[model samples]
Target chain A: MPNILVVEDSPTMRQLISFAMKRIPNSHVIEATDGVDALKKMSSEKVDLILADINMPVMDGLKLVSLVRGNPTYKEIPIIIITTEGAEEDRKRALSIGANSYLPKPIQTQELIRLVNSYLTKQ
Target chain B: MEKETGYLNKADEFLQMFKKGEEFTKELLKENEKLRYKIAQLEESMERSGDEARTKLYEDRIKLLEDEINSLMERFKQVEEENKDFASKYIEVEEENNNLANLYVASYQLHSTLDFSEVLRIVLEIVINLIGAEKFAILLMDDKTNELVPVASEGMAVSAAPRVKFGQGTIGIVAKEGASYFSDNLSYMKEFNPTTPIVCIPLKIKEHVIGVISIYSLLTQKSGFTNMDYELFNLLAGHAATAIFSSRLYTQSERKLTTIQSFLDILKEKPRR
Candidate 1:
């Protein structure tokens, strides 16, 4: 089973992503309210992939990317930035950083499922 | 007396013959009962064999159905995988469209105005909002001093020395050489800022480097330079320079027009000598 960590401040977005990931077999979705919560959760459990949103409270996705990439243990894990359309600047920044990829706002079902399955695939 | 004895012997022989016939009838009846039991057993064995054959047929049918279901499931999975591949391709196309849109916007904004201050403001907006640079400076070449001077800066030291003589500093080299510099490797800039990564590009017009836009430091939260930033830097080199140059000419032309109009008005007010 592939364990996915979803870090989003909005409960609605979290639920949407979780529901979407559930459709993919062998994918276990872990929900985190924000980056801070995500870091705390990641300490105890192993996460195969991370899907995070920018502009979150307490800690933002940029901070999370920096932190995750800085740590040797979790540096190799794939990170995706989920942002709205207007924040194209942040999207570029996300890629320039250590994020593996990104997802646009109003997340597409096919796109999201595709990204999840791709990263969770064994190497 | 002799005739009466012979009659008694004949009656005894007749009774013995009748007993032998009765025994033979009993033995024939027992043998017939045994044959009937054997026939019933044979019929039962045949019926059991028929049931076994029917059970085997039912099992074969079940195996066939299971194989069909397995094949259907396999086909379904293959179709799902194919759909996922298509989705990925669609996303790639969307990204290409996004890039084109960004380019169009960059071009439009660069050509939209001819005011020096507005041009500077627009360039600042593009760098900060579009390129995601938190710390940078825009230095226009001073015609008289032959040096680069900062006109607009963000997240940079406002009080820092704002002059770069030709062939003097990292940005100065760009101005002197009339070429662009874009590399994540910052070993050359060690004389200025060793630790922080930076991106610098010279603004040029008609093969002449007019000004330089350079990033000095990056916020820890901010990501490092991307190829997009290099592309933007390349854009600024041309479009931004043209806007600034045109805005300067427009200002000068307005000033000349004002001077000529005032002189004409004075001539009209004065009486003809």
Candidate 2:
């Protein structure tokens, strides 16, 4: 089964994303309040894919991406940055730091699902 | 005696010649048999070579068929991928259509009631779900006091919401001009400040302004407004104003009827002579 880690500060947004992820066939979703919480969860459970928000309370998503890419242990895991920031610079910076993809909110449910599926099914 | 000796020598020579001719005929028959055996061996080898060539042709045809099958399988996989993409896009479009239908239903439900509190509640619900607002207030204009007072609020205390006079602050200016005010930098607003609302939409019935809807802060995930948000705001500006007005009028009419009934009961009672 694919494990999806959702990192978001807002409870509403977290619930929304988690609900959407559950629609994926045989996907298990893990909720994280922030980047620190996401890292803690990653240490315990095997994370197959990560969908994270950019602006978070403790540690931001960009910092988390850089840390994940720098570490040899978890460098290969695909990370998709979902953010309210739709600027081109934000997308470029996230991809440069090893984010697999960048998706802007007001998220389309089907689009989000399709993007995850692509990453999860990739060899 | 000389004649008889000559005849005997001639007969001996003729017998010798006849014996040599018989030897030559036997050698010729043996050579012809060897040549016939060689021709039979050559014919058998030629037939064997023809069978080998036919086997090689069948092998090449089988290899070509297998290659064609492999290429066909690759094409089938490619077409399946394309179909999946189209299916996903179709689902996305359907989802968007559902959202639009929901908005229309909500708008239709707005005018379905004349209860004052219910209308306000509906407006609040619309803003929360559609606009993604975390903190906001709906302020109505007090006719006698001529100040905007909070009738309903979310994520904040209604009593704490400010009462603004005409042309006093941002909210007041918006009410006076009958135009909506949206902050340029909504992402920077972390806390609720009445003076600088993230957005202030003036509720108007026709050309006359009635009240205002001020959003101090938005949901954390909602960093900025979308086109849908603006469209909803425009909708609330007119529909919300009319709903509130109609409900209030109904309430006042009910109150007047109660007062008149009480007066009629008092008059019907005959005074003690």
Candidate 3:
């Protein structure tokens, strides 16, 4: 019963991600419009993993990753950065800042599930 | 006196014969004891050999059973590996099914609204999320001017929107010919060029070309088009065209109805007498 937090600004993309996450066995998905919204939701819900987009309004995903890593309370939770930014530098930056994984957009749903499952099982 | 001496000699001979007979009986008794000991030793050796044979039989049977168990274990491992492969294939099929469902939902959302802006927004979303297009524009043919005009755009500067006449360029040719054009080589360059769209899909209502959807660039992550992307383009060719066309007609009719109502209101005013 892992709780997956999906942080995306676009409604369509958010719906697509949440739809895929719901297929996991007994997994629960929480939606957030942006990184700010994601941080607010994290305080209330016990999130097991985070799937965030890098380019977002207000607080971006990279900033969120840093903040989450800095906090002792939520630092252990796995964060997967799913974004359209496919550059090697972007990936390296996200990983250096404490993101667990970086997945480019146009995501294969099976791959997404497999990566999440691997992380969740580790937990 | 002679007769008494003969009798004494006979007595001596008989006593010597009896001593010889006693020695012979003692030798026979010793031989019998040795034979009995040899028989006992042979019986013990035979018993030990029988026990060894039985132990060897049991050990061979145990070895055979162990071999059987090892062979079964190997087969079990093979079956487990095959089950894993099957599970992986099932996930792939499920992912394909989900992609189809996404296409269905996108098509459904396109026709669900009659608002012109809403239709445009839905198209924008479909391209961005489904096709992974970073910059694109939707152009509609203006009936009066006979030229394609940009109705909506995403990730493009407002000054970059262009209007093209029939058979003017690639976008114009796509509009005139009603055939989709997709670039063979997708550029990784981030520069936005309005003139050279990587993909230009003409929106058509049956054989009639209504407008065109031009894609300037795709998201960096999308390396090339997929089967799903091609299916979506076909869907937009027909379904998106119909939806946009219906919405535009509805908007125009609404405006005409308001104008007619205004005329009626003026006539009913009776010249303000």
Q: Evaluate all candidate structures by whole-model CA lDDT and list the values in order.
A: 0.76, 0.84, 0.89
Name the docking class for model 3.
medium
DockQ of each: 0.04, 0.06, 0.50
Ranking by lDDT: 3, 2, 1
Better of 1 and 2 by TM-score: 2
lDDT of 1 by residue, B157-260 (tens): 64453578877767788888877766656444434452122677788998988888877654433445555566767788898898888887898899899999
Model 3 lDDT, residue A47, Cα:
98
The per-residue C-alpha lDDT of model 2 at residue A54 equals 89
Cα deviation of A70, candidate 1, in Å: 40
Which of candidates 1 and 2 reaches a greater DockQ? 2
**lDDT string, candidate 2, A15-101, tens digits:** 656767877899999999999999999999999999998888899999999999998888999999987666788899999999999
> Model 3, stretches more than 4 Å misplaced?
A39-44, A57-79, A88-101, A118-123, B1-81, B108-112, B143-146, B158-161, B165-169, B172-179, B187-193, B205-208, B253-273
lDDT of 3 at B15: 79
lDDT of 1 by residue, A1-123 (tens): 888999987554566567667768987899998889999989989999999988789999989999999999999999988765335676788988898887765445557778878887843
Task: Identify the CAPRI category of the predicted complex in candidate 2.
Answer: incorrect
Q: Which pairs of residues have clashing backbones in candidate 3? A: none
Q: Estimated TM-score per prediction? A: 0.50, 0.51, 0.73
Rank candidates by DockQ, best first: 3, 2, 1
Regions of candidate 1 where Cα sits further than 4 Å from its true position? A1-123, B1-60, B83-104, B142-145, B157-161, B183-197, B271-273
Top model number, lDDT: 3
- Residue-level lDDT of model 3, residues B149-241, one tens digit each, is 998998886457789897789999999999999988687336667878899999999999999999999987788898889999999999899
Which model, 1 or 2, shows the larger lDDT?
A: 2
